[model samples]
Target: MHLFSENLAVEIATYYRNVALGHSVVPKVFTLVNGSGSQYLFFIDDLQMERADEDQFLAYIVQEHDAVSYSRGTLVIVEKNQQYIEFAVVDEDDSEAIVCSAELTRDMDDKPIGLSEFEKILVKRESIVFGHLYDPVKLSEEKIEDFESLWEEMKPKILHRTMGV
Candidate 1:
């Protein structure tokens, strides 16, 4: 509904530029929610549609996900069942990246854990962030459709960033 930050202005501009140039911008688009730390950050796009409210937004996503048979874009819903490693999630000059970790994590309750469990804490509050969400990954149409389930399968092989360089 709104730019995640003032920096997103450039991201929005780039989206338009790529659209104008007919580039495959899907990979570059990063839709997010200011879930306010109550929800797992997810990368979701509304296909650039406008909604009057949260109900409308979620409904649109569910409908479109089905109408296209979940074959259109990426969907990464963070879940606790998967293995996670610490990374420095950095925001720099209108861009974001997950970088090598210093090795530590904390849950939503702000509790230090033997291991990181971000999504789990958020999920315990609810199945998924109802009003907002966050996830960390990329996708293909086929993979996007079943992303939540296919995440582990693809995590090891995709993304230069995920390589833990």
Candidate 2:
């Protein structure tokens, strides 16, 4: 998370900032996929409870990401609807944050990756990145292994506990 983003600053401020106290806001959705083409969705809507715990978990995960991350930063998980996950980086002192998204996407040929399609033209895309190791969103062998192990650790704690196997 060294090159972390500040893209979600506006959203955090508009929805989560408190003038007197610190600020906290759920940015958007984030998604995950199990090996067998099943999906798990996670997010914090207006109704969800234990916001602090969820946010803490997200920050921990991002910090513990097998890849090299920052020394003193965390990815606050705000929401997750599908494979596309949105994380918020918030600044309580300044009400600023960066948006990080992990999505299941397709190539130019237009075919779905990981998750099986529900219909003919639905969520179809194969290449997904939990952590963009470098620009252009390509991952190496070590990074892939890191992702797998991380997924294993995260399986049970995830919000939507669904297994496709």
Candidate 3:
């Protein structure tokens, strides 16, 4: 997973808050997603709606993150979800702290209300997608084998890119 340092997350949150307040876009929640599927969520103290734009906002995020090398993998944006309050693990010990106010529901049990309902719910939510790169690490033989099997099914296109393929 592409993990971000705590300092990095705080810096991003501060930047968005400053920009949003200055531009009168008062954003409620901020989120960042790295190419590796790691996510960061930030809750806004006071939110407004005028400053949300995918490209400009992402540009700011990339610049702040010094993520130019992995520009394709870093995404930054804000979200406004009414029902749920999203947050991040600030202190490793306090993973329940409210960091942001929006999140992705990965549980099948909490599936979206319905197509039409989902659309209405998403109207206030904004997102940005980007790419990021991370260092490679070695895995155990069993893990490698498992990854290979999963990759074969989920990312067959990557096979040809592997060394000695």
Candidate 4:
């Protein structure tokens, strides 16, 4: 996993849009799971999480998204089709965000994705260049149990909205 570039992110969104063309509904939120490993990304809408730190962190977000605001959040992009889950935690300060943390579940016999040494090197480089970090760690079963909890909570709401029920 490596940090997501703006172009790459747009490509991903385009990929999904193409996939949904005349086949599936275009989901308002984006959730892409890296089947080869526990790496995935999802979009957050109407977020309600409490701010644990400074109130101004996400203060710049506006109805219309811009390039500068786009870089405000963390970005992680995984290479094609590997058993990995990738997560990017958005923060006001890129350094303050955990550039490389949160490991995806690995398949048996699959080489681990995020190595501390490798991550250290990447993090160091990214820190210097203001590049994003995309390191995926291995997690205990219990730790990642709630990874899809957001989707679970939203499923019903999405269904209702989509179905007009």
Instruction: Give the whole-model CA lDDT for all candidates, comma-separated.
Output: 0.28, 0.33, 0.31, 0.29
- The top-ranked prediction according to lDDT is 2
| lDDT leaderboard ranking | 2, 3, 4, 1
- Against the hidden true structure, what lDDT does model 3 obtain? 0.31
Better of 3 and 4 by TM-score: 4
RMSD of each: 18.9, 18.1, 17.6, 17.7
Q: Return the top candidate by TM-score.
A: 2
lDDT of 1 by residue, 1-165 (tens): 122332233333333334323532223123322223111122233223333333343334333332111111121224543323321222212223322211123346533233322221111212222322222223355644543443344335332111010
Clashes of 2: 17
**Which ranges of candidate 4 are over 4 A from the true structure?**
1-32, 37-42, 52-150, 156-165
Candidate 4, residue 159: lDDT: 20
Q: Please give the range of 10 consecutive residues that has the lowest summed lDDT in model 4.
A: 60-69
lDDT of 2 by residue, 68-109 (tens): 211111223343323332333422222222443333333444
Q: Can you write out model 3's per-residue Cα lDDT over 32-133, one digit (the tens) per residue?
A: 444333443433222222333333333344343333112111112343232332223222122122133322221344333321111101111113122211
Worst 10 residues of 2 by lDDT: 117-126
